[model samples]
Target: MKIRQKSREFIWGIYDFADTIFSMNVVSLYFPLLIVSDLGGKDIYVGLANSISQLLIVLTAPIFGIFSDRTGKRMPLFIISASLCAIGTLAIGFSAELGAILPVVIAFIFANYFYQLSLTFYNSLLPRVGPESRWGKISGLGTALGYVGSIVGMILVMPFNTGKIFGLNTFIPAGGRIATFTPTAILFAIFALPTLIYYLRDERRSKYPVDTVNRHPFKKIWETFSDTRRYPGIRRFIVSRFFFEEGVETAIVFMGVFAEKVMGMPDSAKIVFFVIATTAAVFGSIIWGKITDWLGPHQSLMLVLYGWIIGLIVLAIFPYRWLFYPIGCWIGIMLGGVWTTSRPYLLKIAPAENVGRYFGLYSLSGKAAAITGPLIWGTIILIFSGWNLFAAYRIAVATLAILIAIGTIILMPNKTLFEKHPIV
Candidate 1:
């Protein structure tokens, strides 16, 4: 990477790190457990609640995307949305008392809405800052660093229950649940601050800009949707990724549960598992990103998918907690490439003017799909406590592999395919 590009990637990575903490602490690791284990909500309700939140955003995000497209702005949306989510995270931690499932639920919905909306706009910039050749590397680096944030946030919070820097002693005894509550809130606020601050001051300008927010948000939204109709490759990419992303989301978000509920693992074990995965992701992202420069995004994606699929299969068949390291490492590698590779790849297929609109739809599919994993896996557990985390993981991976295979067959790109019809 050139010095200038490296500089942009660094700032971008910082934003990703700050923002990804929400996914790490609130959505993936801590809050879901807080809801299920502590608040006594069933997985069905948990899943339903999460699903609805995405659905809510799904309804309006494309409109926001269209507005972003019309105005050719990404930073403002990212700052506002991420800030909202950061605040909501604080709201969530404070709502964690035993009797306040309702409050927690409300806060969760709001947090997801803003976090996702922020991502829709954040992703719009993928194609803008970096060279097409280096898109994969750039995106991968940002994503991997984002997961690193997850690792840090979760690690920081573990002291109360787990003891010591390495142990679960993060909590200050007398602070009780409030202690946990305050730290998570403060961290969420602190963690997301960089993203909002940097975005507000960044000097980058969109090549496309317009005066009006969509006069007909829905109709204009449809226009944004219809714009993609001309691109067969983009369609296939969406369908393939709709499945691929879910497995990634499921593992990152629900692994904590799988550790405790199904695998009988401790917090320390969960921390170790995620930390290993997080570390692997950091390196894997760098490697995959570089590969994208050499091989193109699609080839880079295929390579990562192959590694990811193999890992899923291994975990399914082995079903051993000890194997989490190998499997986690496998995931970490491919995991880095997913958002890193896909968004940039999709941008290559989209229209420059519609990056926000299309990316919004792109993110929508993944978030909409996200609700299913928790619901299905959680329900399966309710029925069969004997079912292991590995088995559930296998199912998720297998489903995605099938989707990827079918989509690959339909959308196989031979170099010239994307050049003539860039996504944006």
Candidate 2:
């Protein structure tokens, strides 16, 4: 039993580790390039897809969360959603080969919707992984492993990025871009498998029991949604997180496009930049994991927010390929710190039995802001047509920096949130 429990914790890291494989390689790195360059599409398509996906997640995640809470089970939804995400990703590669944008868009919608749903279920599992005191370390371990996965995923897909298959003698002329999705899907499935299999059979007794009175899942979800005022600290934190996350998600979702249009960077260089950033993220996750436990989640979040503000400002000023090496590292560190700190903080203040619902709302806040960031970035690009491309990216990033600054102010006076969990 002890060994099995330890294995489950390790598998938790595997779950996170798999998520970034698709996130970095497919979504952040290749998809934007495919849209703009290969399919001759606009940034607005990317933005639309991103916004629509978030809208789907925002509407559906809480329903799923309420279901998990009502049923006292998480594995069923995890398995189904994750498997579909992999299949959807694989379909993307095939869609690219067919030279059809509609199929690719549909596949992206399928993959991203399930991808967001997967996180809600995965995060709800965090509270179940161990004691409350170890939440930071556990979340950090998973995030660190996630960055490591990002590095490995990027390396595996590098050949595809360059249009070269290592084993094949011939290159597929633009094949690398489309071929990337297949291998990424495979890698995601391989890492994600252990968790799915383990949880499928190994049901430990539930620490959070189902409520007897709440018979309808939708009713429970509605009540939870309406009762936000009861948790003022969480409400404030969610609002603040919404702002900063807008900055982070915008930067990440469009970094490839920015690199391509602004820096005139080749596909290979873009992959290298992601590798550098993800490597920095690994260290950031480890360092901040400790800080999360020591200084608490709120303080750790503040530190990362400061990093975002400074990093965005510097990148806006420079916006050069050569400079991205250092600038990417700064952004990576903050990226790691954000996920590492936020989850433990949410866990600290949430009602234990309602963990899934709260995380659903947590996902909602981020997704709600997520809808705006891509739209904002894509719209800014449209608004600045024929102007200096780099300047457009800079202005967009500057906008993000201002949002993060406001978020920093909102997050000030953390006394209320911290009072519940002093050490976090």
Clashing pairs for predicted structure model 2, backbone only: none
Residues 1-424 of candidate 2 have per-residue lDDT tens digits of 3886667788888988999998998789888788888899988888888889998988888888888887788889999999999999998888888787878888898898888899999898887777887888888889999999988998777766565533343444445688789989999999999877776565454445664456576777678767767866777788888898888888889999988888898877787788889999999998999999988888788889999999999988888778888999989999999999999988887788888888888998899888998999899888875576667788988999988888889878665566535531
Query: Candidate 1: where are CA atoms >4 Å away?
Result: 1-5, 160-163, 168-171, 174-181, 203-215, 383-424
Q: Which lDDT values do the candidates have, in the order given?
A: 0.69, 0.84
Query: For residue 62, what is the lDDT in candidate 1?
Result: 81
CA shift of 326, model 2, Å: 0.6
| Residue range with the least summed lDDT across 10 consecutive positions in model 1 | 170-179
lDDT of 1 at 177: 30
| Tens-place lDDT digits, model 1, residues 1-424 | 4796787767777767876666766676676677767777765556666777878876878878877777666678777787788777777767765467888888888888888888887777666557676677778778877878877776776665444557434344433332354465567667666655665566353244443554677887666667667875776677676666656666666667666765677666777887888788888888877777666777777767777767766776675778878888888878887776777788777766567778878976777667665566556555544565445555644554554445445446533464533332
Query: What's the true lDDT of residue 242 in model 1?
Result: 64
